[model samples]
Every structure is written in C-alpha cells, then in structure tokens.
Target: MFRFLITLTGLLGALGVGVAAWSSHGLPAFVPAEQLPLALERARAASLHHMLHTLALLGVALWCRQRPGLWLNLAGTLFTLGILGFAGGIYLLRIIAGINEGPLIYVVPLGGFCLMFGWLALIVAGWQDSGAPQKHD
Candidate 1:
C-alpha cells in the first residue's frame, strides 16, 4: 500500500509536470504584455494537473488497504484543500475576473504553499514508516 501510494503520487506528479512542460512549448514567442491569455491557459492546464494530484491524494487516504496514521491524514487534508483553494481559486479568478487583481487571487498562491506542505508531510510519513523497526514473532 505504501509503495503503491508513493508510486502513484510520483507518477501523477510527473505527468502533471510533463503536461505543463508540453503546454509551455510555444510560450517564448509571445511578448510579456501579450502573455495574459497564455498565462491563463497555463493556469487552467495547471488546475487540471493539480486535480490529478488531488485525486491521487484522496486515493492514498481512502484506497490504501492499510490504515493511515497522522502524517498521511494531515498530508491528505493539506493536499485536498491546497488544490481546491490554491489552484481552484486561481483557475476561477482567471476564468471569471479575466485578470489577476482581486481578493481571490491571493488564495491561489496560498493553495500552492499548502500543497508544498502536504508534499512535505507525505515525505515525513514515508520517513517515519521507514524508521520503524520491523517486528517478528
């Protein structure tokens, strides 16, 4: 279960990174002033990518056959909220506001920071599991 969750998260993260990279291929030609639409598109793509991570986090919490401990629970909470509040807020702002300045705009980056914390929590979970001594009867 542990391996599966970790591998799944890694794979999903890699896929998100890959799609972000691919989507960015044509971005260089645009001048800075004209990049608003492009940035919006990227943010939209990132939202979708973040959703994948969000789903993986849920799966890690719910689908794992073993019971989850504190770290997993915290990570899951952070990841879910971060994706929704951070990336979701940004996606909404871009779609609705048509630009960046607004109350909701700050939510986007805060979500990102939450996501970082979530990932860190996940690492800590793995580390804790690894540090536990194996027992045998």
Candidate 2:
C-alpha cells in the first residue's frame, strides 16, 4: 500500500504540473480570443486545485508509511478521486467547448466535496493515531 500510494502520488503530481504548464502556456492557442479569459480562469483554478491536492496526497502517502489506518487510506482514495473529478472535469469543460452544458458540470462540485471530505478524514486519522489514550476526568 505504501508503494502504491507513493507511485500514485508521483503520477498525480506530475500530471498536476503538466496541467499547470499547459494552462499557462498552451491553453491560449486552443481557446478563442473572446473566450480565452474564461478558459484561462477555469484552467488556472483546476491547476491550482490539482497541484494542492496532489501535495496533500503525497503527505498522506508519507504518513501511511509510518502508520496506516482506515481513515488515512480513505483520505488518500478521496484525494485521488477528487483530483481526477475536479481537475479533469474543468479541463474537459474548457477544452471540449460544446460540452460545457453537459452532465460534466456536476463533476467539479462533486470533486470539491470529495477534497473537503478528504481533509476531514485526515483530521480523523490524526486524532486516531495521536498515540496513547488521553484521560479526561
């Protein structure tokens, strides 16, 4: 599981960087002059979330190396799903043009929710693995 997480993290991290670079340097070429601003904005937003969550995934992977738990595994899974749904949705919507009004619209928000839940899961994992039970009287 540790190796799997690390490998996934590496792949996603590279994808995030690639998307960021593409958004900044290559997106303009594909987007129309009038639509470029909105396209660029969406691309940038996707790239930002992608890169941030990829880092979070890396942290989770590293944490798993020392201590693995249900919540930690769930967090990693959610983060990976979130990146694919959120970033991938935006990229599709912006790049595909006519499909903006399609069902893909829901994917971005769903991904955002997953990302938020992943953080909550991390919090749970941290508390669970804090080492030693605390006494409150």
Candidate 3:
C-alpha cells in the first residue's frame, strides 16, 4: 500500500508535467486560433487537477508512513479515483478527437465529487487526529 501510493505519486507528477507541456506547446498547433482559448482553458483545468492531486497523494503516502488510518486511506483512494475520472475524462472529452459530449461526460462531475470527498475525508482525519494525543518519536 505504501509503495503503491508513492509510485502513483511519481507517475502522476510526471504525467501532469508532460500533459502541461503538451497543452502549452503542442495543443496550440493542433487547435485553431479562435478555439485555442477554450481548449487551453480545459487543458489547464485538467493539468491543475492532475498536479494538485499528485501532491495530495504524496502527502497521503507520507502520512501513511507514520500512521495509516481508515480515513487517510479513503482519502488516498478517492484522490486516485478523482484523478482518473476527472482529468482522464476531461482529456478524453476536450483533447482527444474534440468530442464535447460522450459517455464519459457523466464521469466528470462524479470525479469532481470524488475530489471533494477526498479532501473532506482528509480534513476529517486531521480533525480526529488533532483530538488524539500525538506520539513523538
């Protein structure tokens, strides 16, 4: 579990950087000037989610090293799900083949919800941990 989260963090970070670079450089050439702004906007949104969730996953991995709680684990799982569903769906919807609406469209809001739930779970864990005594090593 520990190694998986760390590995996922690294992979997600790399993917985020690659996609960001592609959005900045390659996407402009492929999209028309008039439609460039919208395309770039969605790409930027997806890139932001990917990068931010990568950090969250890293934090969860590090947190698990000290103490692996259920909420913490849940947060990590949801973060992973959110990244796949949210960013993946966005890329498929906007970037690939320019298909605006598709079956994956349902996944977008669910992904966003997952991301929110992930954060909420993290917050709950933090609050619970704060109420408990800390063990200094």
- The lDDT of each candidate is 0.63, 0.85, 0.85
TM-score per candidate, chains pooled: 0.59, 0.89, 0.87
* Winner on TM-score (1 vs 2): 2
Give me the runs in candidate 3 sitting further than 4 Å from their true place. 130-137
Candidate 2's residue-wise lDDT over 1-137, tens digit each? 67888899999988888888888898888888888888888888898899899999999988887787789999999999999888888897646453666676888889989999999999999988976443321
Worst 10 residues of 1 by lDDT: 22-31
**What lDDT tens digits, residue by residue, belong to model 1 across residues 30-112?**
32647657665756566574856657585655533355567876787677677666655654565444457867578878888
RMSD from true fold, candidate 3? 2.8
**lDDT for 58 (candidate 1):** 52
Candidate 2's C-alpha runs over 4 A off are 130-137
Worst 10 residues of 2 by lDDT: 128-137
Better of 1 and 3 by TM-score: 3
